[model samples]
Target: MTKRQKRMAAVLLLLAGLSVAAVLGFTAFSKNMMYFQTPSDIAGGKLPEGARIRLGGLVEKGSVQRGEGLVVNFSVADCDANLPVRYEGILPDLFREGQGVVAMGHMDGKTFVADEVLAKHDENYMPPELAEKLTTPDGKHSCAQFKSMGGST
Candidate 1:
């Protein structure tokens, strides 16, 4: 084969290898990409049943119920909609009623089968999955800040 032909062949082989690598990388990333949805979003039929997803909302007051075998049930709401979640594990220290939370799992009928749960520390804090929803319009803190005893605004 000519030198130019050999060079072209090498370039073609390199492109093919890169394409294969890209496909593999994309496949791996796609599996790890969990979609975030709120109760309202899911209620609107935007989510599919049994699909892996992240649900973010505030824990509803008086909706937490602890059961046997490390099972806990709670209701998550975004004011407009609410979803009941059943988690079978220890919860975070900050997990409480009326606090922001994000649960990762799949939907089973009307309830979310949570594999993991995260709770927001305070009004000024948000779970990593819900940070985008906490952005302010003026680029300031979207969450309510705690005031000092000295009457600082």
Candidate 2:
């Protein structure tokens, strides 16, 4: 082949290889990705069934229950809607009712089966993701509530 033709072939091969590498890299990274969502966002079936996601909201008052082993069940609410969560294993020290929290896991029917649970520490701390979702201008869960709790909006 002519030198110019050979060089063109090499360039095309390199571009193809790079494209494949990028696709594979993106696929691998996406497998570990977990999107954040609130109870209201998923209430209308906006979320894909059984997809991994970060469920964030306030722990509903009086919804906590301790079952066998390290299993604990509770509900997360954005004041307008609530998402039930079941978690197994030790919980964080700050976990409690009437508190903002984020759980990592997938949904099973109407319940979220969480493999990990995170609680906001300190009296003034709130997960930024959860805070943003709850900070609706006219919603019951407003930024004012965060301010009232001594948390920065």
As a whole number from 0 to 100, the lDDT of residue 11 in candidate 1 is 100
Clashing pairs in 1: none
Segments of candidate 2 deviating more than 4 angstroms: 1-35, 121-153
Across 1-153, the per-residue lDDT of candidate 2 in tens digits comes to 999999999999999999999999887775244345667666755567889888777787788999999999998877567888999999888897776777999989988999999884334556899878765443334312321111111
Model 2 lDDT, residue 71, Cα: 94
After the best TM-score superposition of candidate 1, give how far the Cα of residue 112 lies from its true spot, in angstroms: 0.6
lDDT of 1 by residue, 1-153 (tens): 999999999999999999999999977775344345677767766455689888877787788999999999999877466899999998998897777778999999999999999875553545787966764443223122211112111
Which stretches of candidate 1 lie above 4 Å from their native place?
1-35, 122-153
lDDT of 2: 0.73
Q: What lDDT score is found at residue 129 in candidate 2? A: 92
What TM value does model 1 have? 0.58
